[model samples]
Target: MQKEIMSNTLKILCADMVQKANSGHPGAPMGLSDIAVVLSHHLHLNPQDSSWLNRDRLVFSGGHCSALVYSLLHLWGFDVSLEDLKQFRQLGSKTPGHPEFGHTHGVEITTGPLGQGVANAVGFAMASKYAQRILGENVISHFVYCLCGDGDLEEGISYEACSLAGHHQLSNLILIYDSNKITIEGGTEIALSENIARRFEAQGFDVFECDGHNFDSIDLAIKSAKESCKPALIIAHTVIGKNAVGVEGSHKTHGAPLGAEVVAASKEFMGFEKDQAFVIAQEVKSAFEASIAKGMSECEKWKKSLSQEVQSKIAELQNPDFSQVQYPAFKQGDKVATRVSNGEILNAIARSYSGLVGGSADLGPSNNTLLKNEGDFPKGRNLHFGVREHAMGAICNGIANYGLFLPYCATFFVFSDYMAPSVRVASIMKTQVMYVWTHDSIGVGEDGATHQPIEQLSHFRAMPNLLVFRPADANENIACMQVALEMKAPSAFVLSRQNLEVLSPVSKDQVQKGAYVILESENPDVILLATGSEVNLALKGAEMLKNQGKSVRVVSMPCMELFSQQDQAYQDSILSNRNKTIAIEASRGMEWYRYAKVVIGMDSFGASGKGDDLFVFFKISVEEIVKKAQEI
Candidate 1:
C-alpha cells in the first residue's frame, strides 16, 4: 500500500514537472516509478552523507528521466526540495534536464549519453572490488546498481563494458533495464530486433524479468538479481508514459511534456488531486524516511567500526605522498622515446602510490602502458580494458569519481576519437582520468594515415579544461607528468613513437608554464615554437639558422591549454613578435596561430613508409621548418 502511494506520487510529480517546464522527458520517469519502489527498499544510500564510501552506488543510465531522480531524492531525505522539482528544466535550477554528479547531491556519476552510465557502473563495481581487496571486506563492500533503458542497451559501449564486467566476474554489479520499447521516432521495433536477455546471458550475466507495474514482482526480481553470482540484469517490461491519460503506452511522451489536461487526468487517475503539483503525501514521505533511516543506521555502523588498517588505506589514497615519488631521471642527449619514459615514470609512481591504477586498450606492448608485476584488476594495479577504447574512457571516469583512486587509460593517439565523448564528460566533471595516448603523429610508421593522429592534438587542445601535453623529450615528459599529478581535471599525455634526444632536465615550473625557451638566441631573427617531436626538429633547424648568422629562440610548448591560460605578459615573453614566430608540429597546428604567425605543419594525410621518410615526405622536417622560418 505504501509502495503504491509512493510510486503514484512520483508519477504525478514527474508528469506535472514536464507539463510546467514544457521541456524534458516525462515517459521514462513515469515508466520507471514502479522499479524505483523496489529499488528504494534495496538500494543503500544515505542522503545525509551522500559520499559514504560503503554505500551502494546507484547510476541512472537513463538520465533523461531526471524528473523521477529529483522526486525520489526529495522523498528519500536528500537536499532536493519541493521547490527544486517545480523548477525542473529551468536555468540555474537544481533539477536540470539531466542529472549532473557534483551539481546534484545524490548523483553518483554525471550520466546523460545513453550507454556510458552502464560502463560507469561497471567501473564502480571494479573500484569496489579493488577497494575491498585493499581495505578489506569490512571497509569496502558495495553493489553498483544502474537503471538503464532500451536506448542505453542499444549503444555499442554497453556491450564493450558489459563484456569486460563479465570477464572480471563482477557479481556486485546489477543492471535494471526498463524495457519500454520506445524511442524518439516511435517504438524501438523501428531499429532494434535482437533479444536483449539472450544477449546479456551470452555476455555472462544472470538474467531476470518482472512485470514493471507489479511491485511484488519487481521486488522479487531485484532480490534474485542481488543473489546472482555473476553480473546481473533485471528486465522490467514497462509501458512508456505509464499513467499519462492519453499517451500512457506511447512514445509521444518520450522527450516532451504531457499536456496540462493530460497531466491533470493522469494525476486524478493515480488518486492525486487533479491540480496538485509536486505532490508527496505525508505517508509516502514517511515511508521514504524509513528507508533513509535504515541507510543512515548502516552508514553509522560502518563509520563507527573503522579499523586502523582501513584508515591507513583510505588516508594513503586520499592523500598520496607525492614527495615520496622517485621520478626517473633521463640523461641529457640520451635517445629515449617519451612513451618509454612514460612507462618507466608510470611504474615508478605506481610502485610508491597504490592509489593509481590503469591499463592500455590492447596496446600495452606498443603504448608501453603495462604496469609490470601489478597483476590484473580487482587485485593488482593493471586493468586490462582489452580493445574497448570507448568503455575504457568511461570506466576510467567512473574509477576517478569513486574517490579512492586516480584512473588512467591508454590507446594509440589516433583512436582517442573512439572515446572522445567520455573524454569530454571527464573534462566537464573534472575527473582526474589521465589519457596516455602514444604514437603521437605521422611517426606511426607503416600503420599509415589511419594510425597517425594529425588533428587530434589541436582537437583535444581546443576542449575547455582538458590539458593536452605533448612533451618534447623524456625529461619534459616527466615535467608534464609533474603538472598532471597536481591537477583535478582530465589530461591527455601525447607521446611520440620515435626516440627524441633529451635536451636538458626540465623544471616543474617550465612544464607548469606550458612553454619555455629550450634554446635561446640574443635578439632573435625568428622565434621558433614547437611541441613533442617537433621541438627537437625546431632546435635542429634553429642551429642551421644560427650557422647562417640568423638568431632564433626555440620554445617547447608542451601544453597549449595551459599556455593559453598564462598572463599576456608571460605569453609575450615566449611568443615575442608573432610575425617573426613560426610554430612547427607534425599535426594540424592551426591552434598555434594564437601565438605564432607562420606554421610548419601537416596539411595532407601521411603515408605508409618509414616514420622519418614520411615526416620529410610530408614536409614536417628540419628543412621545412627552416624554410618556413626563413620565409617569415
Candidate 2:
C-alpha cells in the first residue's frame, strides 16, 4: 500500500512540475515511477548524513529525466521541499531543468552531459573498490548505481569507461539503463538499433531485462546486481510515456510536458483527489520517516568505524605535512623533457601519498603519466581513462569532489580544448584535480596542426583561478608538480613531446616560488621572461646578448597562477618594472600582455613539419627571440 501511494505521489509530482514549467522531460519520470519507488524506499541512503563516507552513490547519467530523480529525493527524506518543486524551471530553485551537484541535497555529481556520468560512475566504482583495498573491506565498501539512457550508450565514452570497468571486474558498480526507445530528435530506431543487452554481455557485465513498471522485477534486478561479483547492467524496457494518454510509447512524449487538459486527465487516471501540486499521502510520509530512522541507525555504526579507521589509516600512511611543505630538491643543469620529469616527480610524491591516483586518456604511455611500477589502478592505484578525454576530465573532477582521493587525468595538450569545460568546472569548484598535458606545442611534429596546441595555454590562462604551468626542465617539472599538488585549485602541467636538456640553474625552491632567480640580474637594461621550451631559447638569447656587451636577466616563469599569487614586490623584482621586458613562449600571446613590452609568441596556427622546421617557421627559435628582445 505504501509503495503504491509513493509511486502515485511521484507521478503527481512529475506531472505537476512538467505542467507548471511547461518544460522538462516527463517521459522517463512517468515510465520509471516504480523503479524510483523501489530505489528510494529500499536503497540504502542517509539524508541526515549525506556525507557519510560509506554510503552508496547514485548518479542519473540520463539527466534529462531530472524530474524523476528530484521527485525521488523529495519522496525520500531529502531536504528538497515541496515548494522547491513548485518553483521548478524557475531561477534559484533546487529543482532545476537538470540535477546540479552541491545545489541539491542528495545529488552526488553534476550530470548533464550524458556519457560523462557513466564514466564518472566508473571512477566512483573504481574508487570504492580501491578504498576498500587500502582502508580494509570492512571500513569502506559501497555500491555505485548509475541510471543511464540510450543516449548515454551512444555517446562513445560509455564504451571506453565501461570496457575498463568490466576488465577490472568492478562488481560494486550497477547500471540501470532506461531503454525507453526514444531520443530528442526522434525514435532511437532512426539511428540506433543494435542489441544493447548483447553489447553489455560482450563487455562482461551481468545483463538483466525487466518490465520497467514492475517493482518486483526492479527490486530483484537491483538485489542481483548487489550480489553479483561482476559489474551489472539492467536494461529495463519501458514505454516513453507510460501514463500520458496522448503520447504513450512514442518519442513525442520524450521531452515535452503534457498539456493542462491531459495532465488533469492523467491525474484522474492515477486516482488523485484533484490536480494538486506536490501531493503525497500521510501514510507515504510515515513510510519515509521510518526509512530515515532505519538509515540513522546504520549511520551510527558506520560513524564509529569511520572515525577510528580514518585516524588509524592516517597514522599508518604517516600523513605528510599538508601545510605548505617544501618542494622536492632538484640539482641544476639536468636536461630532461618536462613530460619525463613529470612522471618522475609524480611517482616520487606517490611514494608518500596514499590517495593520489593518476591516469591518461588512453595516452598514459605517451603522456608519461604512469607511476613507476604502479600497477594499473586495476581496482587499486592508477586508472586507464580510455580515449574519452571529455569524460576523463569530468571523472577527474568527480574523484576530486569525492574528497577521499587526489585525482589526476592526462591527455595531449592540444586536446585540452575538449576538456576545457570540466577543467573550468574544477577551477570554479576549487577542486584539486591535476591535468598532465604533454605534446604542449608544435613540438608534436609530423602529427600536423591538428595535434599541436597553439592557443590552448592562453585559453586556460584567461580563466580565473586556473594555473597553467609549463616547466623548462626536469627540475622545473618536478617543482611545478609539487606546487600543483599543493594548490587546492585546478592546475595544468603542460609538457613538451620532444626531449629538452635539463637546465642546471633552476632550484626546487625557486620553482616552488613560481618565478625564480634562474639567472642573476646584472643591472640589466632588459629582462627575458620565458616558459616551457622557450625558456631554453631565452637563456641562449640572454647569453648571446651578454656576449655582445648587453646586461640581461632571464627568468623562468613556469606557473603564471602561482607567480601572480606572490606579493607585488616579488613580481616586480623578477619582472623589473624599469627594465624593458620581452616574454617568449611557443604558444599564443593572449596572456602575456601585462608582463612584457613585446611578446614573441605564436599568434597564428601551426602546421606539420620537422620540430626544428616548425620552430623556424614560427620564428620562435633562439635567434628570433634574441632579435625580438634586442629590438624591444
Candidate 3:
C-alpha cells in the first residue's frame, strides 16, 4: 500500500511539473512510475556521494521523462530540491526539459536523442567489466540500468550497441523497456511491428516481460534479468497514461499535459485529495530516506575494504601524472604518415597509462590505432569495437563517465559522419574522449570521393567544445596527441594517410598553441597558412615565392579550434602584418578566409587516381599555391 502511494506521488509530481511548465511529456513517466519506484528503491546508489565509483548507474533513455527523474532524485535526497522541480523547462533550471549529464547530480549521461542512452548504458557496462578486471570485482562490481521506451528501440544505434553488449557478454547490463504503445504521432503500431523480445533474443539478450504498473511483476522481471548470463531486457508492458482519469492510455497525453481538471480528477482516482499537488505521504518519504541511508552505508563499507592498489588506481584515473610519460621522439625530415605517428605515440602513452583504452571501428590496422603488444581489452589494453562506429563513440563516452578511463574511438575521417551525433553529445557533456580520424582528405587516393573527407574537418571545427587537430607531420602528430591527453573536452585528431615530411625545428609548445611559423622570411610579402598535407606545400610555395624575390612566411596551422581559443594578441602576432595572406588546404577553403585574403582548397568531390595526381588536379599542389600567392 505504501509502495503504491509512492508511485502515485511520483506520477502526481510528474504531472504537476509538466502542467505547471505548460509544456513537456507526462504520459510515459506516469506509465513507468511503478517501475521507477521499484528501481529507485532497489537500485544500489549513494545520494550522499553521487560520483561513488561502484554505485549502480540508472539512465533514463527516454529522457522526456525528466520530471520523474528529478522527482526521484529529490526523493533520494540528492541536491535536486522541490523548488528545482517547480522550475522545470524554465531557463537555467537544474531540472531542464531533458536530463543533462553533468548539469544534474545523479544523472549519468546526457540523453535526449532516442537510443543514445541505450548505447551509453552499454558503454557503462563495458567499462564496469574492464574496471572489474583491473580493480577486482569487490572494488568495481555494479549493474547498469536503463529505462528506455519504444522510441529508443526504434532508433538504429540501440541495435548496434545492444548487439555489441551481447557479443561481449555484458551480464551486468539491464535495460527496462517501457513498452507504452503510444508515440507523439499515435500508437507505435502505426509504424513498428517487430516483436521486441524476439529481436533482443536474436541480439543475444535474455528477455523477460511484465505488467509495468504491477509492483510484484516488475520486481520479479528485474530479479530474473539480474540472474541472466547475458545482457538482459525487461519489456514492461504499460498504458500510455496508466492512471490518469480522462487521458489514461491516450496518445494525447504522450507529449502534452493532462489539463488541470484532469490532473485533479486523476489525483482523486489515485486516492489522493483532488486539489493536492506535489504531495508526498510521510511513509513514501521515509522509504526513500531509508534506502538512501542504506546505500551510503554500503558505499562507506566498500571504500573501507578497498585494497591499496585499487585506491591508487582510482587516484591515478582522477588525476593522471603525465610528467613521467616519455613521449616518442621523431627526427626531422622523416617521411612518416601522421596516422603511423599517432599509432606510435598512442602505444607509448598506453604503455604508461593503464587507464588509456580504445579501438578503431574495425579499422584498427588501417587507422594505425592499435596499442602494440598490449592485446585486446579486459585482459589486454586494446579495444576491438568492430565496424560499429556509432556505438564505438557512445561506448567511449561511457568509459569517460567511469572517471578513471581516458577513452578514444577511431575511424576513417569520412566515416565521422556515421558517428557525428555521438561526437556532438560527447562535446556537449565535455567528456574527454579522443577521436583518431585517419585518411583526412582527398589524399585518400583510388578510394574516390565517397571515402575521402572534404568537409569533415570544418564540420567538426564548427562544433563547440570539440578540439579538432589536423597535424602537419610526425612531430606535430605527437604534439597534437599531448594536447588531446591534457584537454578537459573531447578532441579529434585528423591524421593523413599519405606520408608527410617532418619539418625541421618543430616546436611542440607552439603546436600546442595551435599554429606557428614553420618557415619565415624577413619582411614577408605574403603569409602562407596551411594544415596537414598542405603545410608541406605551403613551405615549398614559400621557397618558390622567395626565389622570385618576394619575401614569404609559411605558417602551419594544425588546429584551427585551438588557434581560435588563443589570446587575441597571440592570434594577431601570427595572422597580422602580412601584405597578403593566402590559406591552402585540400578541403573547403571557406573556414580559412578569417586569416587569409585568398583560400586555396577543394570545392568539389575528389576523383580516383594517385594521391599526388589528385593533389595537382585539385590545384592544392606547391606550384598552384605559388601561382596563387604570385597572383595575390
The TM-scores of all predictions, comma-separated, are 0.99, 0.89, 0.98
Ranking by lDDT: 1, 3, 2
- Per-residue alpha-carbon lDDT of candidate 1 for residues 507-588, written as tens digits (9 for 90 to 100): 9998898899989776899999999998998989999998888999999999888888899999988887999999999998
Please give, for residues 290-369, the per-residue lDDT of candidate 2 as tens digits. Answer: 65566667778876767675767745443344433333455666556788878777777777676778798889889888
Clashes of each: 0, 8, 0
Candidate 2 structure, TM-score to reference = 0.89
Off by over 4 Å in 2: 273-275, 305-311, 314-320, 323-328, 386-391, 417-429, 462-465, 501-527, 546-555, 561-581, 593-597, 603-610
lDDT for 137 in candidate 1 is 82
For model 3, the superposed segments whose C-alpha errors exceed 4 Å read 577-579
Cα displacement (angstroms), candidate 2, residue 162, comes to: 0.8
Model 3 lDDT per residue over 1-632, tens place: 87788888999999999999999999998999899888876688888888899899998888899999999999988899889999999999999999998898889999888998999999999899988888888888789999999999999889999999988889999999999888888889899999999999998999999999899999999999989999999999999887999789999998888999999999889888988777877788878777557678889999999888779878987888766678777888889999998999888888788888999999998999888887786687688988899888888888899778888899999999989999999999999999999998988999999998988878888999999988898888877777777889999989999998987646568878899888876667899999998989888888788888899888899889888889999987787763489999999867888888888999898889989999989888888878887787
TM-score of 1: 0.99
